[model samples]
Target: MTSLDDLPIRDDLRGLTPYGAPQLDVPVRLNVNENAYRVPEAVALDIVQQLARALPDANRYPDREFDALRAAFAGYLGHGLQSAQIWAGNGSNEVLQHVLQAFGGPGRSLLSFTPTYSMYPLLAQGVGMRWVPVPRADDFTLTPQAVREAIAEHDPDVVFLCSPNNPTGTAIDLETIEAAAEAARGIVLVDEAYAEFAHDRSRTALTLLERHPRLLVSRTMSKAFAFAGIRVGYLAADPAVIDALRLVRLPYHLSALTQAAAVAALRHSDAMLSRVDELRTQRDRIVDELTALGYRPYPSDANFVLVGGIDDPRATFEALLERGILVRDVGLPHTLRITAGTAAETTALLSAMAALRAE
Candidate 1:
């Protein structure tokens, strides 16, 4: 049998594992931070119509620019954004990879705080860029001072700030973002994949773009829009930055069906995002119930909670899995990261945790 070792591959990737969350068949799945709700039927129908319209053009290549999709994204973002400033890919992962390919290279470095999106280091290594990890504060919050110091020391080619950060759910303040742009001589990319789940959506890096040409803000339709399966992600930056990304992007990267579906979803944006408030409610419920169970639930602005104070995280994770519930153990000692699901799913999780406590 052939194996990875038998083929010639990059030595840098020898021991690294692929980034993924468990995809087990379970009754209750609260892992991966995906939007728990199914896409609204009306919106789904409209997407079908759009895809049908696009099917006739399948023989021809898709619009290389995806101009209509870009316009729709600009209007949805609504921070005085223009279509010229937008760039997108199959998913936010591809969008980020585009940035790395354009701006990051062999000698350059990518810097971000530790315990952030697990994909950051992998993306850096794939591009042959040096990965620099800086520690966050004790509460998992990042401060302006910390941003300044890290940029000064590392002087990386790019800095990534994950607002409403994953696995912990701590949001980065605008002050810290400004400080980073001021201190770093390279690109400042803010990953706002969960921004719609934040308590104050107004406080975003998009507001800083007017003053900082090097700043960029990336978003995904997978979470808030419940459009995960469609694979749409975009970012806003200066027009010059978009041109740089274009240099590395594949020709007609986004297929015609993808563009049509995404544009149709954006057209019904209000209906697609109607469940956001409910998700926020469920997330708060998780925090409160976990605290009452004597666990330490960190303050979260995203639709998930990072719980500490467990005696054995892996054991508890396995127990939950046995009960047909799946959550994430993000390798945080004595901690487990659980996503906010529907009300009934929450009830099941809390009941299981209560029973675990009693035992």
Candidate 2:
């Protein structure tokens, strides 16, 4: 019999490694950009209470339309419910997959900037779409001219921009997004996964909905809202674009329990806001300390900082691991991306760094 592994895979997916976050038993878990905190006890109890109220209906399938949860999400964002401008998926990552399904396929292409959220290319490959990347400037900023040129040259079906980008943690400006939207013949997706931690007000891209029918802005509750494990993400776009997403998404994509949890989380927005403030403060403290140690840390508006040019980043990573402190060593040589942990965890990292440097 022929071996299953001998069967031909999609050419685009032939050599791809499965994507995942690191798993290490460490005291300071700073590798993934998790909220670095837990849901408050009060919020946890309220979620339990809400779910208890729905226990009898637990046997029933979740709402296929997910209307109530969608409305709550839009209301939390201060957008109108009747506008048909929003969507939700298991995670923003899934939302990305749906976007690819809607606009990209075997013969089409997906475009994105490099050193961005790594998932973009993977998602494109999974859909059997061609993936194209344009490199950012050394400082990780996108130029309108370069973007316009790429749009004109490649004419891709989809483009993804991760603002306050992953790995680098630097944000692209509104002008860049708008210019990309104008120049592109296809969809322009702005992944604002870290927008809440940034200083700039969210551009929403909803504001440009009327002008750019193909624009979509994706957001996640995983980071600032401390809901990573619960898995909720949303998109804001023109009604037409959202309709396209709705067509491709799985029915009841948002579970009843998840909907309840997200609603409760949104209801306590004030408390979540407070946590964001605290995390931002901690992130700044980490940046200051790392810079004082002579490491070049990128100016970040997100919950993590990307510091590069360390000597032997792998050795540094290993040393930190030995001390029960975990941080991410991105593929770049001598560079590490550190997520902000609690004050105590941050102190542990600093201590580990000091010990490593002294050696």
Which candidate's TM-score is highest?
Answer: 1
State the displacement of the C-alpha of residue 131, model 2, in Å, after optimal TM-score superposition.
Answer: 0.4
lDDT of 1 by residue, 64-112 (tens): 9999999999999998999999999999999999999999989999999
Q: Which candidate is the best by lDDT?
A: 1
Pull out the clashing pairs in model 1.
none
Off by over 4 Å in 1: none
For all predictions, the C-alpha RMSD in Å is 0.8, 1.9
| Global lDDT of each candidate | 0.94, 0.84
TM-score for each model: 0.99, 0.95
Looking at model 1, which ten-residue stretch has the lowest summed lDDT? 13-22
TM-score, cand. 2 vs. native: 0.95
